[model samples]
Target: MAPEYALNGLFSVKSDVFSFGILVLEVISGLKSKGFYHPNHSQNLIGHAWKLWNEGRPLELIDICLASSCMLSEALRCIHVSLLCVQHHPEDRPNMASVVIMLGSEIALTHPKQPGFFTKMESHEAGNQSSSTNEMSITLLEPR
Candidate 1:
């Protein structure tokens, strides 16, 4: 979920863009954003991707299965566009049309600003955490 929608129940085109960015990352990494655990870090899949990107190691994010089949430049372009889609501010994110153009062309992409909702958890804190996700659910039906 986009940070604004998750925190304030607000949804918009930009929120959908955020979701698209996550989906792109998931496809590239072959990992789900939620329940993503890294042995050496507490960052989720998005945070991990962002870190690798910032460190000039974005290619490390590609799934091993795709290494032989995918074009490296195309993969890098997708990563760049995905980052643009997930900018911290809604106004900074491009519309769907712009995103489509970006993906289809070799236009130089602007550097992405920090992503929203990337609060880092202390490694120890992450390990000591319980199963609560801070979300509540109500069960209305009983098993037959």
Candidate 2:
């Protein structure tokens, strides 16, 4: 689920883009975002992908099985496009038409900003505990 939808009960075209981005990441990595686990960090699949991307190791996110058959450049482009779709702000995300163009062409992609719900989980935290990160707090001001 997109962070805005999950937290604010808001939904939009960008929300579907976020979901698509996650699906792309999951497809490439052969891992589910909800239950993603990494021995070295508490990041879920999206965070882990972002970490690898920042470290110039995006290829490391690809599944080993596909590594043998997938075109490296295409995989990298997909990752780039997926990241763009999942930007933290809905305004920052491209529309579906742009996403299709990005996937089908060699156009240059912009660097992805921090993703929504980018919060890190505790290393000891279990997957069953709140699948989505809840970092934002709302304090409703009610005057009596």
Candidate 3:
């Protein structure tokens, strides 16, 4: 979750950008952004990615399917770009235009700061939760 939206309930373009970042990571890692488990890390996917990135092992986040086919530099570039999108503050996140440019070029990317809402959920806690309010259970709305 974007910190502002998660904490204050204000959604904006940047919030969408934040979601995009997590989705990108999810696709690359073959894991859910939230409730991702690894006995070794005991942290969510975002935190795990950050940890691996700092340790110069960002490629470990790539799913095995992609690892076999994807180029090392390209995969690392995607991870780097995703991290920039998920920065702790909306202002810190690249605008869509910047993101597009960043993805298309080999230009140096600014190192990403820690991401927001990065935390662990033990298996029991993670599995027992109900759907979030942000989810729309039904197609249409009704007047209350």
Look at candidate 1 and give me any clashing residue pairs: none
TM-score for each model: 0.84, 0.85, 0.82
- How well does candidate 2 match the true structure in TM-score terms? 0.85
Residues 91-131 of candidate 2 have per-residue lDDT tens digits of: 99999999999999998888999887766777667444546
Whole-model lDDT values for every prediction: 0.84, 0.88, 0.84
Better of 1 and 3 by TM-score: 1
Candidate 1 wrong stretches, greater than 4 Å:
122-144
Best candidate per TM-score, number?
Answer: 2
Residue-by-residue lDDT tens digits, candidate 3, 8-95: 9898679877888898899999988654777675677888998899999999999999899988898899999999888879988998
Q: How high is the lDDT of residue 48 in model 3?
A: 90
lDDT of 3 at 33: 67
If ranked by TM-score, best first, what sequence of candidates would result? 2, 1, 3
Q: Which predicted model would earn the best lDDT?
A: 2
- Model 3 regions lying over 4 Å from their true place: 122-144
TM-score of 3: 0.82
